[model samples]
Target: MTQTGWTAGRSARALASLALCASVVTACGSASAAGRPVVLSYYNEPDSSPATQDAANACSAASHGAYRIVYNKLPSAADLQRQQLVRRLAAHDSSIDIMGLDVTWEAEFSEAGWILPWTGSEAQQVEADTLPGPLQTAMWNGKLVAVPQSSNTELLWYRSDLVPNPPATWGQMIADAVQLAKEGKPHYIEIQGAQYEGLTVWFNSLVASAGGSILNANSTAPSMGAPALKAMQIMSQLAHSPAADPSLSVQQEDQNRLAMEGGTAAFEINYPFVYPSMKSDNPALFKNFKWTTYPQVSTSLPLHSTLGGIDLTVSSYSKHAALARQAVLCLRDPANQLEAAVKGGLPPTLTSLYQNPAPEFVAMYPFYKDILQQLTTAAVRPKTPEYQAVSIYISHTLSPPGSISPASNLSSLTGQIRDALDQKGLIP
Candidate 1:
C-alpha cells in the first residue's frame, strides 16, 4: 500500500483550478455526458486485471469531480488497437479523450497530429525521473508527444535445476541447448518467432545487441550491414538447430511462455509476466524457474533487448484537452504505476521505483536489479512515421525462421524497405 513517490508534477497543480468549471465550459451538459463531472473516455487495450480500471478510478477521485475517466477497453491485439484509434482520430472524433498507445506508435500518432504533445512544464515533469529508455519512446521529432505509463523488456528464463550456470552469449546458449537435446532432456529454446510484431521485436533486439540498427539514425531506410548479418546468422542458427521449438515459426510471447511452463523447454526469452504465471500454474517448475540477463549476440557487445509497454496520450480532438492531460498524469502517477507493477506485472517507467522499490514491489519483482540493468541499455524499435509499414516489411522477410538464408533474406528486406520508404512498395 506504499506509494511509488513520484511527484504529481505541474500538470496536476494547473488542472486543480478548473475543478469548478469543466474544460469544456460551454459544452458542459450539452450532449451524452450531461453531468457536473465531465466524462473523459479513455480507450485502451482490455486489462482483465484491476490495473486499468483502478487507475481510472483513482484519477477520477483525485480530480475532485473535475472529470471522470471512463475506461473504454479496446481489442487486445496491438495492431487492432492502433487501427481503432487511427480510424477515430482520422474522423476528428472527440469521444476518445485519452488513449493508451503502444510504445512504437508515438512517432506515427505524433506525425499524424492525432495526439497532442506535452509542452512546457508538463513535458519537463513527465520526462524527469523517468527511465531514459522508456522516455526515449515518448519523444517524436524532439517533442514529448506521450507520457510513458509502464514499460517491459525481455529476459532469459531458465530452469536452474538442470543448468548450473546461465549462458552469457547466444552461441553458448545454443550449444548448451543442443547438448541437452542429445541427452534427451527438455532442450527446446522458446522465443517469439511468428510473422508479426513479435518477429520484428526479435530481429530488432538481435541487430541492436550486435551494435547495429534496422534503420539509420533518421529512420528513413535500412541500415542492415555487418551487425544485421550477425543478427541474421544468430537467428538462422537457432532456427536450424535442435534447440528450436517444433512450432517456432508460429510461436508468440504467450506461446513461448506456455512452452517453458509446459516443461518441454530448457530456456525461454520472455518478459517478467512469465514469472507470476509459472508460479501460479506450475509451482514445482516455478521452484526451478530462474532468470538472467538476456543472452547476448556477442560477449563484448551490450544487449539491447527490445522495449515494450503502454504510453498515455491526450487525443488532439478532445473537447477537454486540459482535463484529459491532467487525468493522464494522475493515471500514471507513482501510486497507480506501483499498483500496475505490483499487481498487473507491468514495470513502472519511473527510475526511482526501481532504485527504491517498496515491499510489495520487491515481492513481485525480486529480480528488479537485473531488470533495471537491462532497462539502462534497453532499445526501442525503429522510430519512424512509417513504423507500421516498416514493421510489416521486416516481419514478412524474416518469418518462418527455419528457412532463413541470412544473406538473401537481408537483401530482400533492404530492397523492400527502400521501395516502401520511397512509396514504391505496397503495405500488404
Candidate 2:
C-alpha cells in the first residue's frame, strides 16, 4: 500500500492554486429554496456508461422529494476534470454536492480537505462487499474518503489465430513476437508508452510485478532499487525489438487498440473497453481476439496490474451533505454497477458482482476471471498529494521507452522523484 500522509503543509503551487481559485470561482444557486427538493449537484465525467446517469436518476426518484441528484457532466480528460473540481472546491463552492473522483484524486482531494471522510454506519456500508483494490483507492490516511463506483484493469489481449496460446511472461511474449516478426506476420506488442499517467501505470505495474514499489513505505523517498531497474531493462528490451510498435513512445491506450484492430499488431495490453470497441469496429478481427491475465515480469512473482476507476465522494463544501451521502451509496448499488459493466464496459467495484456475474456481463467480459484475479492484487500508484508531480517526473524520464538506459536512468529517476516529493522539482 502507498502512504498518503499530508501533514507537511501545502506547497507553493497549492497556495497559488488556491489563490487562483479565489479569483475565478463562480456563484450558483443555494442547495434549495425551501420545501423544494435539495438540488444535490453531482459533478462527474461524461456518462460513457448509462449506469452513471441511471444511478443519478434512480437515486433522485428514491429520495422522494428529499433531494434531486443532478448529473453535471464535466470534461472528458481526467486532468481537465480535476482542474474544474479543484477550483470550485478550493473556493468552497456549495454547488457541487457530490463528485465522481478518479481513484488517484481521492488522496489529493482528501489531503487538501476538499472531500469529507465517511464514518459510522456510512463507512461500513461503503466497505461492505467492495473489492480490496478499488476500496483501497477510496481511502486516505486510514479513513474512507469516498465510495468505489467503477473499477478497471488491463488484460493481455491477443490474436488467437496468430498465437494459439498467450505468453505467460514478458520475456516469453517478446520472444514470441520476435519469432512471428521473422515470419513477416503482424507481431507488434501493443501497450501504453506515452508520456502521461498511462506511462506511470505501465511502469508501476511492472515494478510491482517485479516485487518492488516506486516509493518507500512512508512515501517520502524512492523505493525502486533492483526490481525497478530490472523492470526498466525489460521496457528497453521491448522498445528495441522489431516486434515493438514503431510509435511505441507515442502510443496511448486508444492508439494501442487502433493498432490491434488495424491488424498491424497481434497483442494488446488494454482495458475491457477494447473488447466492446473491437466487436463494433472490426467484427472479423474481433472474432479471433482473446484475453488472458497480464503478463508476469517473473514466473516466481504474481502479476499485479495497476488499478483504474472512479469513486463517489461528498464535497466538503456541499450545503446538501446529508442528501449527497445518501445518493453516493445508492449510485453505487449493485444494479447500477451491473449496468455500467454490461453497457459501459466498466468493471464493478463490488466483489459479489464477479461471482456468477449476470449473463450479460459475462458476454461483455469473457475474461472476467482474469480481471477479477488481477484486480484482487492490483497495484496503486504512490499515494502522496504529490502523485501528479511524481508521475510527471517519472514519465518525463521514461518517455520514449526505447531511450531507457536502465542503470543511469534509474538513478536519475530516483533523484527526480525525491525532488517531486520534496516539492522542489520542475517536471518539464
Candidate 3:
C-alpha cells in the first residue's frame, strides 16, 4: 500500500481502539485528565521561518490549557501536499485537525467534504477584512471553507537599470526584448511555460487580461474562445521569438527567478517570494530589481494577474472542531499576519496591513503599492471540483508553447478540458 494508505489504515485502527477505550472510561479518557492537553495537528508545507512556529506557540499558550498545536510538515511541492491530504481525508482520519491548503485546492477539498465550512460571525469577519480576490479563494459553492493567511499575485519584474520605462503591454515588452537581443544584450523575457500548475496560472492570467475567462461563471463548460486564442497566440509568438528563453518549455517559477538573478533576463513574471530570494542570493542583482503590475494584453484591457497563496482550513473529521476553528482565528489575527509578513516575508492577506505596512515591509516599499494593486485586481483560476484535471489537460495540451497554433489547437484544447471535467477519458 502507499504510505498515505498505510497511515490511513493505522489511524483508523488507532481511532477504533481509542473509541473502545473511551467507552469504559479507561486509559484513553484518563490521559485527557492526566495533564494531556487536547492536541491539534496542523499540516502545512515546509517553511524556513520560525514565524509560523512562534505563532503556534503563542496560540497554544493563549488556549489556557485548552489545546496545543503539533506542526506536521508536508512536502514542499503542492501536488505532493495535496496527495497526502487527500488520501488521509478520504479515509476520514480524525487526527487531521487543521491544514494549510493551496488556493486552487479549496474547491476540490470543499466539494469532497474534506474541509469544514465556516459560517456566521467568522464568515462575516473573513469576508469583511480580507482582500476580495484572496477571500474568494477560500469560498467554494458560495460558502467559505477556509481562511486566507497570506495572499500572492504575480508581478512583472524588470531590470530598472536596463529598461527604465518598462513596457505596458505584452506586444511592447516582446518588441523591446527582441530589440535588446538584436543589440547582443543578455536580456530575455522569462515566464513559466512548463506543463505544470505554473503554466495553468500563466494561461489563466493571460486569458483574463484579454477580457476572457477559462471557464464560464458556473464552471460548467469552457468559456474560452477568441480571447483564449489571442492569448495562446501571444504565448506562442513569445516562445518562438528571438528573445525567448531556450528552456522555456520546462521552466517553472524558480527557474524564471534564477534567470532574472543571473542577469540574462530583463523581465519576468513571478510571485513575491522572488523578491526576498533574490535579496539573499545575490544582493547585486537585487539592486536592479523592480516590479509592477503584470503587463496588459492590450492597451484597452486591464491586467488581471493570477492569484496564488495558502489558506488555513479545518478538517471535517477533526475531533476538536471548535478548538481547531479557534486556532485558525488566532493564527490569522492581524498581529500574527503582520509578524508573518515582516519575519517570513509573506504578503499579508489583510487589506489594511498593506496600507500601513510595518517598517520592514516599508523598506521594500517600491513594490508594496504594486503588490497591493495586483492583489486587489487579481484573477482567480477556475473554481470547480474538477479544476485539477482541467488544469492538467490545459497545461499538457499547451506544452512546448512554441509549436502551438491557436487556429489548430483551440478546439482540441477546449474539448479536452470539457472531457477532463466530465471524467470522459481521464482516469478516476
TM-score per candidate: 0.91, 0.91, 0.90
Q: Global CA lDDT of candidate 3, please? A: 0.87
Q: Rank the candidates by lDDT, best first.
A: 1, 2, 3
Please state every model's RMSD to the true fold in angstroms: 7.0, 10.6, 5.8
Per-residue CA lDDT of candidate 3, range 44-66, in tens?
87878888888888999999878
Residue 160 local lDDT, model 3: 85
lDDT of 1 by residue, 1-428 (tens): 12222135334533553553466576544532444588899998898789989999989988887898889889988889989999989999989999999999999899889987799988988999789889999998888999999999999999998777999989999999999999999999999999999999999999999999988988777898988888889999999999999899999999999999999999999999999999999999999999999988888998889999999999999999999999988999998999999878899999989888999999999889888887778978989878888889988888888888999988888888887767676888
Candidate 2 has its poorest 10 consecutive residues by lDDT at 1-10
* Candidate order by decreasing TM-score: 1, 2, 3
- Clash number for candidate 3: 0
Of candidates 3 and 1, the better by TM-score? 1
lDDT of each: 0.89, 0.89, 0.87
Which regions of candidate 2 are displaced past 4 Å? Answer: 1-35
lDDT winner, 2 or 3: 2
Our model 1 lands, by Cα RMSD against the true structure, at 7.0
Candidate 3's C-alpha runs over 4 A off are 1-36
